[model samples]
Each structure stands twice: as structure tokens, then as C-alpha cells.
Target: MMKKIVPGILTVFFLLISLQKVQAWGFWAHQRINRIAVFTLPPEMLVLYKKNIEFLTEHAVDPDKRRYAVEGEAPRHYIDIDHYGENPFNVVPELWSDAVQKFTEDTLQAYGIVPWHISRSYSWLVSAFREGDVDAILKLSADIGHYIADGNVPLHTTENYNGQLTGQKGIHGLWESRLPEVFGEGYDYLVGKAQYLDDILDEAWSGVREAHYALDSVFNFEKILTEQIGSDQKYSFENRNGRLVKTFSKAFCTSYHDMLDGQVERRARISILRVGSVWYSAWIDAGQPNLKELIKKVKKGKKGAENKDEKIEEEKENNGHKLKIIDRESSDLLGMRDVHEMLFGECEGHGMGVGHGHGRPNKPHTQTAQGQKEGLWPLRMRDL
Candidate 1:
């Protein structure tokens, strides 16, 4: 009886251990992009933004949270442009209607629509500005920031996004979450002022196109590095936020960072500028409304204007673990849990949404994620 029970327990243990949760561009990076983007606004825009900077930063990860709760949220975060063609832009129509007409909404969504979604987000922000709707402006700004940051990530552009196709699984979290958490402090955040976009849709598509161009390097560098260092050395288990996590070693991350030669930093910088620029453009297009007056008109909702430091305090206590709430967003917060191996036994309240935490299996990082063998696909498409 004892032997039988022990084997059953061990089987359950490995099963849990094998389950992995994937997150996109770490939560820290996403929030940081939104927070810093505020400073990039000109005085006209900055006046309003600086007033509500806290709201923008805290809500930056809201889009990721919506993935679990909201329908069609996953596809908005990324695009498997590679699925369309080698030269994706050339084959896929630039306009949303044209794309839908060509591929049908179901097929377009069966892949992803991040670039087009950015355009939609931009338009909403413009409307918010035009109407002086403070709530809409802030919400849309935070959301648009999330999408633009996703667009900048090379991993977010591919069919083999998580490296499952090439046996380099976990690369998604490694590149987006770990690298920035380890080395982002040194990155310069002063990206100058935001500028108006003459062609919002064009720029949105450009971001996705450029990201696609860098896809090869994103995969090859990791593949080559793993071969040189071996997986054991490439990844190391260390204590993070009071738990042991298997993540890329500093040496390994450094080597990979060097190989990318500013790719990650460049992408992050572009995300910051784009976020700020789009926000600024929206304000200008809205006829430069008086944001102070607009703020007064904002309706009080479920949560009042709580202390801005609430999130900061939470971050300090959790060491950024709160953001990891399984379904929240991508960051070390959602690093795979070792329930049986750890003294804690089981994760108490790990993820944010229903599918989050211990009960549910990990969902794919993007809805349109393909090449699902070897558990590489964390982002899932319902149709596929």
C-alpha cells in the first residue's frame, strides 16, 4: 500500500513539474515602458500624463490579464506572421478590411492581428482624446503600450515563438522575462520627446515587419548558444522571490545578449518611444483638451483613486511576484512552481485569473501559437 501511494504521489509530482506557464515581454518591462513613456511626452501632453503616470504604469499589464478573462485577447498580443508567408507583409494586406476580405476574419484570427489591433487601439485613444474622456484615454494608453511592446519582441512575431519547434523550449520566457529583469537597470530610459505619427497604421505594420526581420537571429543565437554551453550550464536553478526557479544563467544570458548586439535593448527603446508618440499624437488629434478638467470628470469606480504606491508596496513585498499570478502577464512571477520539491508544498495563490493558480493547465502564450509538440506552445489558438 505504501509503495503504491508513493508512486502515485511521485507521478503527480512530475506531472505538475512538467507543466509550464508562458508570459510575454516581462511585466516589469511592460510597466517600465509605460511609466517611462510619460516623461517622453511634450509639456502639453506631459501635463496630463504626469498627473496620471501612476495609473498608466499600474494598469500596463491589464491587457495581459484580459487574455484569460476576455475573448479574442490573446491574438491581439502577437502575430504569427510567418504563417502567412516568408515575406508576410507582401502577402498579407495592410488594411484590416482587405486582410479580412482576403483571408476571412476567422482565418486572420486563426493566426494573429497584433499590428492591426494596434491601429484599432490608436483610433480608440484618438476618440478618447476627442471626447476628453479621461477614463478611456488612460485605459487605451496603457493597453496600447502593452501591444506596442509585444510588437517589438522578435519572439512575438514567429510561428515557432517558444522555440519548441527547434528543441529550444523556454526561450520565450528566457528572452523576454529573464534578460530584462537581470540587465534592464543599466539600460537608458531617456528616449527624448514623443512625435506625431503621420501614418499610425503604417507604423504599426512597420513594427511587426521589423520584428519579423529579426526572427532568424532570435532563434539562431539561442540554438547556437545552447549547443556551445549545453542546457545544464545554459540554464541554472536559483532562488527567485523565495522560490527556486530554473532560468538562464547570467553568463549564458550575457553571451546571448552580446550575440543579439542590442536587439533586446533596441526593441525595448522603440517600444517606449512608440508608446509615448502614439499617446502624444492622440492628444494632438483631440485638439489638445485640458486634461486637468477632464480628470475631474472621471467617474469613481469600484476602486477609488487608491495610493499610487499600492502597486509599488506590493512589488517590494512580493519582489515582483504579484505580477506572476499565473494568468497575469509574463514575468518571473509566473516561473514554474516546484510544489512537491519545495518546502512550501503547493502554491497558495499563484495566478491572477481563474485559469491561473494550480488548478488549470498552462495556456499558450498567444492564441495563434502553432507547432504545439513537446509542450512548446503555451499560447493557444482555439481553432487550431
Candidate 2:
């Protein structure tokens, strides 16, 4: 009786752990998007981004981590376009000011503001490039990549993101997380070099529209496959991190992957190109700053113990603002918890909806393009 009880307790404990992981199971894709985007950069911007590849890759999921810790952070990760109606693009205004005027800021926050947030973050990235702030540039680059990647996910754009409303719960992780975890190695990521966008806002909307267009296929394929397969064949326990964890069976994933007809790979490839293009555009907007100089300055600043003392003094002069920036950079290096691992424990509460803490109840506060020049960081760093 005691031995049996111990096994039951362990199963319960692991299930709880898996639930936490499902919330962030998509972190791997986010990190992969940022990492691969580095290769898409041109020689000019590539010099800086490539040197700090690890920083960009690791911090790609920083926004996801802030979802629970930061108040307004969750809304930035997604937008529920379906909440607007059948023709959301026509109903919702493209410009942030226009959207706020039409829907009221509170209403907008209650839904989502991802596209607008992407535009806002792009402006901030441009400002960082112009100011030649290495820390800010790198941080914002990683963050914008995360948002752009989210924009490409069909689930991130819908009200029934996790399929809770359709009774096919857990489809979110199955599509975005498990499928990639199993077959991503074979997916082609060579999306070609990044191209410049004339209007970043238009580009952001286009990506969201494309992803939204694929929304039906995302759900329909899974439903069809579910009907054909029994529960035992649909899911299986596998060893992950030295623990038995339940996940979508490889055979089921393969069938779903085939049904999608390369949709997942296509979206991921587009995300990579878009991320790199945005980074390049920001640099171009900043008058094509010599990124090599910024790299040199960073190297110079790290030279000696004497220079470190001077850095401390400089931070004191700036009221520790510089120290705060350094601390943030250090935190990125130390790495945050991968939200994907939390999915392995339990799969509940993973819905990307307004009520599930995915959207902010209060209005979002953002800096104008002009304000970013004065070093006004947006909600990302402010709430953190």
C-alpha cells in the first residue's frame, strides 16, 4: 500500500510540473527565430548581431517571461483580432491612435495590441540604433524578434487560441510547441537575406493577416486527425529531462505535420526573414550607424579593473541608471527559465486570451517615436 501510494504521489507531482511548462512551451521556437534571424542580416548590421548571437537567441523569450511578472506585458505578446468581428482588419484601425479613438484604450487593452506594439517596439529599436546604446539595441532587438515571431503564430491572433472554446484543448501546445520540438530539425530555415520594409506598420499587419488566414487550417487539421486516432495513439509518455512526460505522440505529430502541408515551416521561415529585415530597417533608419564602432566601444569598456571602477563612477553620476542597464544585460546572460519546460508538467491555463492574463485590463502606456530618442524605454523594461 505504501509503495503504491508513493508512485501515485510522484505522478501527481510531475503532472503539476508539466502544467506549468505548457504555458511557455513555445519558447524554443521564439529562441530559434531570433537565432536564425542573425544569419539573414547584411554585412553591415551582421557584424554586431552576429557577435552577440547568443545574447539575441537566449533573450528572445524574455517577453514570454514577463507575461506573468509584468502587468501590460501579456497583451504585447498577442492580439485577438477575432474579437473585433468577421472582418477584423476592416473593423479595427491600423494606426494606434485611430484604434484607441475608435475602441477606447481600455477596450483595446482588454483584447490585444500586438501589431501596434510591434510598431512601437520598432521605433524604440530605431532610437536605440541612433543613440548607439549597445545594451538597449541588443535588448530591443531580441524583444522585437519575440513579438514578430508571435505575430506569425496563428494561435496568437485568435480568441480561441488554445482551442478551449472548441473542446479541442491543448491544441495550442501541440501545434506551436510539440510539433516543432519533434520535427524542427528537418525543417528548412534558409529564408534568404533580409529585405528592407518601406513601412514597418504595413509589414507588421501583413504578417498578422497571413497568419490569421491560416487559422482555419490550424484547427481543422487537428480535429480531423483527432477523429481518426484514438486517445492512446494520440498521446504517449516519453522521457524528457530524465522524467516520464506525456506528449503528443510522434506518429500523431507526423500525421498532423503532413496534414498541415508545411504550414509550420513556412510560418517559421517568414518569421526569420521578418525579424532580420526589421533589425536591418532600424539600422538604416538610424542613418546606417557603424555597428563595428559600437562593438569596439563595448570591448574597450570591458578592458581593465580601472575601467570597471570608472564605470561604477559613471553609474553613480547617472543615478545608477547605467547600472540598471548593466544589471538587465547580466540577467539576460544568466538566462531566464524556458517557459516550454513548464508545459511538461500540466497543460492548463495556457490559453492566449484576454481573461487568462494575456491582455492588460488597463490601458497600455507606450512611448512615441520622438520620445524614444530621449531614452524613454517602453513597457518591457519599465514594468520589469
Candidate 3:
């Protein structure tokens, strides 16, 4: 009786743990993973993307669900970058080139793309194609959509990233998830073909730089308009969770539109459209194949097995864990209870249309961000 009860309790504990992981990665993770799949898509699958908009429709919420032919390609978030260094930013984009050499197949025995960092996503696709599998390609295409979508976001690339700032807190969700929900679908999906990137690191760093520059308007333009426009016009009343709430105002939209000079939405739409195109491009580049061939070599999703077998498999994976494929967090951070996780977890509370903390901190960063040379330091959670 004791043995039976213990097994059941263990099973329940594991299930609960799994559910939090599903929730903690947030909507962006799903989107980012799709971009990985995009660069590996085959020709037939590529054509399907343009012929139909259904992919975008069904996947906008959780795009990473599309499994690539390669097992374990779509993975849990949190790159194991911390293991390699004290601070990734100190090295800058050099990490990307290093990743290329590391993935170039020195110690690695298999012919697959490595998942070193979230930013190295594109490099993985470029190499995965050499293996030549259709299912693998499509899987990466779906993942590509996710990353490109995240790229369009201003916060994902910034350190002030989450708006732990001057009381305009939770602006991260407001800008990326909220605004897109209300206004994104209406965006035009007709962007030009994705030009082949000669150097992925250059493109990636360029993206980071672009997102960095946008921080000026995202963080400052709101304040600039406040001096001239009335407060009421900058927000609107809406019912959320049966509660009447004042949200962003028409004047705020107008001001942002002015700040972007009308490029924000267009760029977003371009990102989505390019996501599809790249997915297709990857399939073509990957040597368009029959998905059936790849299906023969790989299986989809995990299946339940006997307890002993499961234990053995888990132990095996744990022992052989590769930095190229794993993301990690501190034991304390990973072990926090649900409510604690929701408040502090990477993927909850502030996502989408939820909440914004918008305020100053008791202690703020003395320095500003990279592009903000005018100030003593980039304004952080304290300045808002």
C-alpha cells in the first residue's frame, strides 16, 4: 500500500511540474521557436504558406506546437548561456560567431543544428538543411515565425526589457502582446521576399541595434506627447475580466504613430509575412523532400512508458545533457511555488493584456542603455 501510494503521489507531482513549465515559457517562446522551423522548410511546404493564411491564424497564439521531424528540436526555453560565462552582454555578438564554429561539427558526432543561444536560431536552420529532411525543415519554419515575431518587438531585445521601470511598469506586455492583439491581424501580410542573409550575425546584430534605437520612442515619446496632449485622450475605457479599465488612448496611438512615422505596424506586418516566406525558403534550401521519408526516421511527441523505463530514460538524458541543447535556471528559481513563479517566472502575469507595473524602483541603474549617450545612464525601472 505504501509503495502504490508513493508512486501515485510522485506522478501527480510530476504532472503539476509539467503544467507550470507549459505556462512559464509565455506566448513569445512559441513564436520564437516557429522561426527556427522556418529556415528549414521545404518547397512544397513553402508554397503552402503563401497559398493559405490558416497557418498564421491557427498558430498566432502558440506557434511552437508544430513539431519538426527532428526530435527535441522544439524545446523548453532558457538557454544555458549562464554556464559559459558571468555576463553574455560583455562578449556581445562574438558569441554568435563562436557558436558557428562550435556548431561546425568539431566534438559533436551527429549531423544536426545546435541550439546554443536563442539568437543562434537562424544558424541552426542553415546547418539543419545539410541533413536534408523535409519534416525537419517545416518544423524549423514554424519556429522561425516565432523568432521573427519576437524580433519585431521592442522589449525582447532590451535589458530594460520588462519595464521594471518608472511606474509605467508592465509596458513590455502592453507594447508587444496587447497592441498587436487589437491591431495586428489587420496588418498587411504582403512583404517582399526575404533576401538571403550573407552574414547571419550581421543581420542579428542589426536587429538588436534596430530594437535598441526604437527604445528611445518606446520609452520617451510617450512622455514627450504628455506635455502637449490631454491625459484623457491618451487612454481609453475598456472592460477586462468584467472590470471597466482605462487603457491606451487615441492620442497615445496618434503620438506613437507620429513617433514611428508610420513604420511600427508596417514592420510588424513585414515580420509576419517574412516569417512565412522564410519558412518556405528554408524548405526549398533544405532540398525539398517527402515528409514521409523523414517520418520513417523520427516519431512525434513523447508517449507514456513504464515507470522503470521512464526513470532510465530520464537518467540517461540528464547524464548526457549537452550545452548545445539545454536551458537552465538556478535550483531556487526553478523550485519556487506556482504563485511565486507567476509573480517572478519568465512567462506569466505581465504577458499580453494583463498588467503593467509602470513605476520607479527604490534603487535604479545609474547607467542608461547603449544608444542613450546623452544621459548619465540609461533610465531604468526608476525613471519609467
Top of the candidates by lDDT:
2
Q: Write the per-residue lDDT of candidate 1 for residues 298-340, one digit (tens) a residue.
A: 6342135333213331222333223211212223323343322
TM-score of each: 0.72, 0.76, 0.50
Q: Report lDDT (CA) for all predictions.
A: 0.75, 0.79, 0.45
lDDT of 3 by residue, 1-384 (tens): 455545554665565455434433345434433433333334545444433334543354332322221133333121222223454334433453565575443322121121232235554564466575433344444455565655555665544555665445656655665555555545554454455444444444444445545666777765666656767676789786588867676557656656756556655655655555454444455565444544444433213223223422112242343112111222123233233123323231111122323232334334334522331233222232
lDDT of 2 by residue, 1-384 (tens): 556545654665676455447655588888999999999998988888998999999888877765654357788878899999999999999999999999999988988888888888899888888888988899889989999999889998999999999988999999899988888989999999999898998898998999999999999999999999988799999997799988889999999999999999999999999999999999998999999988888778776534554422123334323322333433332222223222222222222222222233433445455433433333332221
How many clashes in each structure?
Answer: 10, 14, 43
Better-scoring candidate (TM-score), 2 or 3: 2
Give me the overall lDDT of model 2. Answer: 0.79
The weakest ten consecutive residues by lDDT in model 2 span: 345-354
Better of 2 and 3 by lDDT: 2
Question: Candidate 1: how large is its RMSD?
Answer: 15.2
